[model samples]
Target chain A: MEVDKGKGEAEETRKVAEADRDTVTLKSSDGKLFEVSKEAAARLSTVLAGMIAGGSIDDNGTDLKQIGSEALENVVDYCNKHANSIPSAALISSSISFNTAPFKEPEEWERKFVDRLSHDALFDLVEAANFLGMERLLDVTCHKISEMMKGKSPDQIREVFNIKNDYTKEELEEIRQELAWAFYDD
Target chain B: MGRHSRRASPLDVDDLLAEILLCLPTLPTSLPCASLVCARWRRLVTDPIFLRRFRACHWEPVGVFHTIFQSGREHLSFSFISDPPPGSILHDRFSVPARCQDAGGGDDVYTWNVRGCRHGRVLLINMPCYDRKVHQFLVWNPLACE
Candidate 1:
């Protein structure tokens, strides 16, 4: 009985060690698995943090059914990159002046990270980041999209985003007249 | 994992769309131009909550409003002095409404003094020419042109 008790305690210790791992395995909707630093995942994502805190994380792979494999890969890549990058002085100072700063500009590496993505991949990553509650990643992705929107005509914007122009000619004319100054080339 | 087909665009979600739109450039033409994209975008950009959020996000002064008074003229003319990265705001985009200009009618000349400006609004005090007494107060929103 004592030998059995000792073995039981050893098994319990092994389970606890597994649960206390430094990294977590996540399963994307397509059933692919990715590993991320537990600390980084918890820090970067509110949903992951909640799952971690609530002890709901599965050892095999905590399922993220809303995220596709490609987008989840990008999320993992961003978290890993964020972990390695040092926060710049501007970032630190901006954090201190939180009330005055609306959004912190993305670091250079971050800008490059999202810049290389194809349009579909970028939008997919945005949805994934938003689903994971990753605020910084969402900001970076959204900033890239907004930059694409700047300086484009409405027709160009519609073309780029695959949006259908629903206004009749008369309705469009009325809006143009109402906000004529906005359309001035100068 | 099996490769799946592409998902729907995130912009289909209104909340996500707002997040993207919230980051647009802070120029005066940004929202107005965006409103012409589609009916959905038009509705989103004109929403009071979205406008409030946009104001909060881009709090820097876009331009200045100054009154130009010509001597012996009955009315005060306001001009927008644009501060720019090229085309921020047009000089004539904002104007004092005709109602305010017509307030002092038929020889009862009133001097208009700008009391304050805050949150895209201007407060004016209309004082009768014959006396120092405050005759009336007028609140104006040049953006709405009302």
Candidate 2:
């Protein structure tokens, strides 16, 4: 089954003039529903895209429910905004000097963007990225994951991942001794 | 409770834990602790996955690994192998270093050699095509590429 191009072009054109667009219906696993952006529902979610493309999507201005609703919404919003926004040439040149958008010296808008999320939300986004197969999302998640790894010993990581230690005390000690140097930094 | 309802679940938390541990990346250091969690976990320690890729490095075991087969051994060949079949008669047999005298500095003697060292981290290889000689060797610690 083939979907019409881009969730109806006239609808998108009308919404560009007006903001706070009408909701796209999303169905949840337990037969729940949620209302979200048509732009977002169209662009970011491959699952949603497949539904539309396959002509399986009902989408009649109803609540769009999702199994992982918040996670789905966050991902859609991120993708939609990122897709539409143009990069600042001034920021581009300035960023090149340092090769990074300095997190410490971030713009007010950037700070507010992250401030809205909870730890659980952050984790759910990572899972969402993995589910969506988004590389940019994966990099963000991996960097977030590695950042968590920093300053943490092996035991801490295992615990964080809900991993249980299978080594005996003596064996653990022996292994620790073998990798004693790894504990120290360069 | 009735007799049928009185029985406990067949699978416990530990059983689930064992499956999780077995699914982890095989790191030699983590195996010992992971196996000790329980008998099921202990059984997973012997799984080839835990034994195979887990030994990423740290096999630089200091010892005399070779016999001095020749006084003027210039070059050799090496094969870094992880596991050889246990209790096989051919384990280290047919795998002897055959060495003979080669000219010092500016000489022509060609032979190839091969060896296994330290859970298979490094291979020390020496081959001379002109003089037709091959030498095999393995290093306890393989150095980083320059």
Candidate 3:
């Protein structure tokens, strides 16, 4: 009986240790699961880093109820891509850095990654990025949206964003006249 | 617009929407257009906090406005020319004179004369020449008009 108890205790310790596994399983609101590199998620997302450090990460699937399946999949994809592309040395060195460094333009691959996303996907990713406190991802996604807005008129912008024109005709004319230079095309 | 109807909710969050709009390349052209989207959006774009953040993100001056003193017929006209960003392929230059409707026009009291420019504000020497030198100045922000 003493030998069996000792073996059971040893097995418990091994099971607990597996919680510190290199990869973390994230569960979406739709019951979908995505496996992301634990180190990369912790490094890129402050919320994830907090969860990891707080020992709240579940070896099974950590529930991310706020994120949908598609958004979670994109998040996982981004983490994997970031881990693969960013040099390990840079990641290690930039682990604790803030926004002190100058904003670097997104790489061609990053640009293409965002460009391929549909408008809804892009919006979802931005929300996810904000929720996760992923500043770089937020910047990249915002930059892509801004690019789409380039050279677009107010009418076009309203149409694209699904925003209604609240200003009356007179009010609109007043504003347009007030900022005539801005409204004029180059 | 037709395909992506339900996707608008995510962007309805004002803070997230502001973040995306703040990423615009230049404030002059795009932001004004964005402000006209809706009342809420206009308020967000015009908010002091949002403006400060936008300025922080884009600290570099998009273009420089220089003043050229021209001896016109009646008044000493100050022509402000906008200099494009460095390495710009297009060279489009336009100038507008300093106009102060309130300031009385005469030899002693005129609109303004460009003295200098520092930190995005144009220092203008107000008329009322005392000992061949202007006594007052109007520290004006041209960009504020935008």
Candidate 4:
């Protein structure tokens, strides 16, 4: 999960030295500091891009009070990795100009990026990604979560998401009756 | 500790969680099971907007159902022949149980015939009911019994 720690830090320090730095510092809700490439942040996150464009970014640490430190760290990590990774020609060509084109599957590295996180961390990253307007991150994380639910039953899904079966026994029976074909196939 | 054992904050937001579940591959099976998880989930799954999005994402029909009426010695039997995957052979079939027992008053025999079928439901018309001259219609979802 610590993606390119030495190189990322070195790049951040170099950006700080330049007259116009290419990196931006973000402060999580808990006051922890994380730095991400400014170009990547703007390109990936519409909210960050707007803040950067409107000069709302505070040099000390752009406060992201809505996101916790762990989630913010994962967001910054994803942005850095995205900046470094190159999209394949097929991926570039397959992307249509439509507003809601089918999203391309996550890359191998991106899959590994989320694969390492605990379920809590994954869900946190999803919320943080949505908060940041990181559409691709949201899609990738959501896809991963859905992948976990592919073959799981209702009881299993409840266990996975820590959701309580709030339906009454009668209601449960009725729903089970309604969707009996689904269970029979299993 | 197990990987999912952490008491993670639940993603309880309807839209957000729906968006995640909407990404599930098998909609017909997955969404129904998901709806049983909770009231909020059931609401989301059965919501008009959510169903529209789910249909848009998962566009293919799972199977086609055909209703066949057979005259038995004692009573008229209404059965549904399922030709799943469209062009495939008839793999599974089952009878649609009589929804209303008293459709025919007194000793008058009642027989059910398919009037129309659409959207995984069969509209059946009951014949020769002594109590009511008008044909009684019953909508039956045969797959629900499977």
Using all chains and alpha carbons, the TM-scores for the candidates as numbered come to 0.82, 0.42, 0.81, 0.66
Summarize candidate 3's per-residue lDDT along A60-169 as a digit string, tens digits: 79999989999889999998998999876777665468334556688988898898898888888998899988888888898988787777777887777677788999
Model 2 chain A is weakest, by summed lDDT over 10 consecutive residues, at A94-103
Residue B88 CA error for candidate 4 (Å)? 18
Residue A180 Cα positional deviation in candidate 1, in Å, after optimal superposition: 2.3
Better of 3 and 4 by TM-score: 3
- Rank order by DockQ, top first? 3, 1, 4, 2
lDDT of 4 by residue, B105-140 (tens): 445355566777565567778776555444777777
lDDT-wise, the better of 3 and 4 is 3
Q: Which candidate tops DockQ?
A: 3
Candidate 2: count of backbone clashes, pairs at least 3 residues apart or interchain: 33
Model 4 misplaced regions, further than 4 Å: A1-19, A87-100, B1-10, B59-146
Tens digits of per-residue lDDT, candidate 4, A1-186, equal: 367998899889865675277889999999999999887787788898889888788888999998999999999999888877845442243212311456667789999999999888888899898888888898889989888877666788878777778889999888887766655532
**Residue B54 in candidate 3 has what lDDT?**
82
**Model 1: how far residue A103 lies from native, Å:** 2.6
Reference-based lDDT, each prediction:
0.79, 0.44, 0.73, 0.72
- Candidate 2: docking tier: incorrect
> What is the per-residue lDDT of model 1 for residues A1-186, given as tens digits with 9 covering 90 to 100?
999999999999988997789999999999999999987787778888889889998989999999989999999999899878845543343222432345777889999999999888899999998989888899899999899888877888887887889999999888877876655543
The total of clashing pairs for model 1 equals 0
Name the candidate that leads on TM-score.
Answer: 1
How much does candidate 2 score in TM-score?
Answer: 0.42
Per-residue CA lDDT of candidate 2, range B36-136, in tens?
A: 34445556555666545334322333223433433464323222233322321121222323343355545544443544444535455556646555454
